[model samples]
Target: MSERGGPPQQPIIVRRVHRRGHGHHGGAWKVAYADFVTAMMAFFLVMWLIGVGTREQRAAISEYFRNPSLVPGNATLAPPGRMGPGGASDSAIKLGGAMDLPHGPGKDTRGAAAASVDGRTVEKEARRQEQARLQELMQQLRAAIQNSQALAPFKDQLLLDITPEGLRIQIVDKLNRPMFDLGSAQLKPYTADILRELAGFINRVPNRISISGHTDDAPYSSGNRYGNWELSADRANAARRALLDGGLQDAKIARVVGLAASVPFDKAHPGDPINRRISIIVMTRQAEAAALSQELADEDAAPPAATAGPAAASPAALPAASAAAAAAAPGVLVH
Candidate 1:
């Protein structure tokens, strides 16, 4: 037969047969897979517990894992009436059999409570003594202001009051006599003299000092970059610098705040010259403790999470606006 005329060539046929597993390779791999899955589940559960549990709860869980016998009877796994090892009652289970006595947890808790009470009492007594000392110091400061030749001229501008925080002294502006130059944060010669005298008396007290700057309701203009808040803060910082220059210790000033017009000396007259002033407060021990606690709390807080957009930016971080509107905002200047 001719090759071309040969019957249609048959298509090539290929067969592939996959082999099955050998009989000897039994279910060993299945067992291993099961074990791996169980281990993973247990790991995930432990991670979840650690992530969600509080400090005390985590400590308790860790103790239980270290020594299962240490788990209290109140736990779901343990019976209520059962006693722990080493003859400890169910009410008290000392870990690792450390305590041989049968005393309950209540005894230790009571002792701790008593100690706390005693500590509070001692703190109270110490605070009372400090208040008395600060009171005496306030009187001395008033007397010194009245008697001192340099401070006498400014006495009319200075007002003294005893507040809950401690002694509060306010220095206010007069119609013709301002503490600072117009539209500047520079301390005048007389203002410096008054602050210098104040620093000398303030040094005699152990309490910390707090300085604040205030302004009238009249608007201020400092380009768009500066506003009332910035101006007030600058004046306060300027006052702080003057106090430090006048023999006051750097550590003595606890806070320098700028209230702007929030706290007006003359409440009925927001635009009054007296509303533009500087305040110095000698903080009481209790107030100081509270302030320190708040500071620590603020410091220990976590940073805010970042977000996309200008909305995430803080007001303090945002770019300044036009000064046209800021001209109406209250501000401070130290001359």
Candidate 2:
């Protein structure tokens, strides 16, 4: 319909609408982030605790976490599925069993224990026992020698010692009773008695013996062709024979060596009275003549070419030299 001189006007309608500025602050994301951080921290703490704790400590920890109420003060709860602090499950405490404790210091609760001994220790103990026995025997021998009127005079000249080789008894020559006559290798009467008593003592021992003769650095007379070397050897052999006759077994005599004046007893005083002596050595199991002979034979049987190379060349060239040079070389022969 038309009104107030206007072309066909429609009816007007009014309505009010309010626009909200922004939604209320949503804290759900913040809560989720805080929960994630707390979970990560708890996981790391558990890992650290596990790494440092022993088996027993770990079992105790599992019990504590599963059921705080299962602790000593709070034992009224049920065995399993009981509430812990903050209402968590108590299943871990009921399921946990006793754990093995760690070993303390000095406790060897492992496998079968060892014997705590070896070959070297046994050998050392045996050697110690042998040495003690030998020392006791030496004391007895010394007492016997001191009590004998015939051996008392020779006590000062005798030396008894325990060496690496074994027991060594040396009889040194003095001015009053020389072990042998001036130039001859004959033993005196009293010397023979003393040797007989020594032989009696040696017969009791089950070890091998070595008789060695040494001389002072005194040159022989020109008229006498024989030198100290031959005299020493003869004297040593004579002593061996006398010992055998005096009840010492021949099988126990290992070797008879004559060093002449090469190995002096007192090096500072080469011609000392002690240098002229007869040394009776009891050989140890290791230093026996048999072992030395075996070692020597092995050395000798090694390739002759390896041992003879340099020594053979000089002998081969000596055949072309003068006869006088060859003769002067002792064992050399000239063509």
Candidate 3:
């Protein structure tokens, strides 16, 4: 203090108080918070979609999430330049076609088209061969029925026709000569002989068979449980047994059902004896696949508790869900 002439008697100390700006809650924290909110919103949106979607739709969505890069129509993330053979960017070669670029995106359009055409052609050929084989089978069945002494008398009751489903052979009930006892599932000796004769030819073919029973629309109320449904199903099962007795393998029976007057042969007269009949359909490959898919869908829709006992032992019953999925593919019957 004495060394300086201006400040003489006392030394003055200047103290500065530096105050920090309000608690530095930086923009980074805000950014993190915003990101969290956005992620939560997306999560909620995905949950809503899953809740409303069907099984197939849900599977598709799951697949998309698993690999978003593989989704169609997604823009390819690439630099605008030629990539060297080793995958390095080569700036020297500019991207140009004949007019403006050398080539389009790296896609094999010709190969894809060729593959699609080949697939369609193969399917067409398969269908044609299947049709021819089924036609030959139909002719053989007609000849066999006409030649058989056991089935010759009952020829008027048998109806054979080729349908999109394949060869359909229906044995209609006559007013005078019913196939079964009056209102019973028991088959007459003549009906059994006819079914057995058909089975001999049916077993020779690789195609699977679908058996169904139909009934007239008469009012039936025997007790509380027994009805036309049970009767019809029993009759179909009886026919299935007869076919097995005549050499048809159990695995060859693709479907056995009871229509119970729903699909009538004589629609004009629902109560006609002709409507009360048994139908055997040799399923085409396409028809069999479609029918199996439908059955699987129905089974998946049913509850687990309904898959047991005689009430559930109908032909409409499911095998295993895994079995259904494993069998689901476009082709002839695997067995």
Candidate 4:
């Protein structure tokens, strides 16, 4: 095609496709920028975690991301002799932590552990609140003992403390002022008055009470059928009656027991007059439930059979370790 009359001189024309901006304002650049920001954020998050977390946490995190794989909780690309397609191993073949996430026996173990931890936390909080309430009750009783003119006279005998079971109020015997008549379960007039006074204060709480009577090492001469055990039991029952007469609810009495001389208040001096005492424990709800359970079991026509030999006999009959453990642990908690 000759345009200029000579051999083929083409017309010169320039066609320019103008770009608004040099790809800087395009969506692709925005996407790249977003990726950059995400990378920076992830980097900073990793750094923050490194600063805050423990060594174990860091190791676990590192292990979690060590090999980026499709399967979670499994890291192996291909286990030896168990290789699958694409020269890799399946989730079942991977040998690592979090056993069988997609499917297996221990898949729910972590969930169970988390649930257990939560349960423990809740239990701890409840226990703390209960302890605070019991402490407040103790303070109230102490203040009463301090302010009341009638109770101040026998303040030396009134011993109050907190046990895991509940708040224990022990009325000990002084050398000059014995709580009961000589060699008898009969309470003195003053002792009865004291118990009567305590009844109203204790009735303020809804908690049930456990009454336990203790004796000194002195042997009571009442024959084999009735000795210190019977005397202590009678004394505890007497105290219970006094409390009841003083306006305590009949249902408030959970248990009444006499320990004889088995658990002396003054272990250093077992024969001390203070060893002969009465312990009134205001039991917690949990403890009350346990007590009820035990009582129900005992009352059942066919109780669960314990080993015939050891638990039946005295702690003295057991091995040294067993005896020590028995002494340390709260057996039946209260009477």
lDDT of 1 by residue, 1-335 (tens): 45788777667999999989896689888988999999999999989978986554565555444443333333322334334433334455443534444336523332354456656667877988877887887788788878999887788898887777678888899989999876677889899888988898888888988887877878877667676656666788899988988999999998877666666677799899888898898888766776677657645763556744454533322212212222345331111
Scored by lDDT, model 4 comes in at 0.75
lDDT of 2 by residue, 1-335 (tens): 66577788677877778866554466777988999999999999989979986554565556555544423322333324444344545344444332222234443211111112233446667777767766766787798779988788789888899876678788898866798888677888777778888888887767788887778888866464676767777788888888887888999997776666666677688777678888887766655744466546646865676664555533212212322443356422111
Deviation of model 4 at 37, angstroms: 23
Question: Which candidate achieves the best TM-score against the true structure?
Answer: 3
In candidate 2, position 329 carries an lDDT of: 61
- Clashing residue pairs, backbone N/CA/C < 3 A, model 2: none
Model 3 residue 44 CA deviation in Å: 65
Reference-based lDDT, each prediction: 0.71, 0.67, 0.73, 0.75
Greater TM-score among 2 and 4 belongs to 4
Q: Which stretches of candidate 3 lie over 4 Å from their true place?
A: 1-107, 304-335
What ranges in model 2 sit over 4 Å off? 1-117, 221-225, 289-335
Q: Which 10 successive residues of model 1 have the least lDDT summed?
A: 316-325
Backbone clashes for every candidate come to 7, 0, 5, 0
Q: Compare candidates 2 and 3 on lDDT and give the better one.
A: 3
What is the Å distance of residue 107 in model 2 from its true position? 30
Better of 1 and 2 by lDDT: 1
TM-scores for candidates 1 onward, in order: 0.60, 0.53, 0.62, 0.60
Residue 212 CA displacement from its true place in model 2, Å:
0.2
Compared with the true structure, what per-residue lDDT tens digits does model 3 show for residues 1-335?
Answer: 57666666766899999977675655777888999999999999989988976555565555444443311232232444323222333343444531122344554433454456656667888989888888898888778778879888888999998777788899999999999997789999998988888888887778888897878988668775666767777899999999988888888899887767656677699899998999898988888898889867777876687466555544322323322343354232321
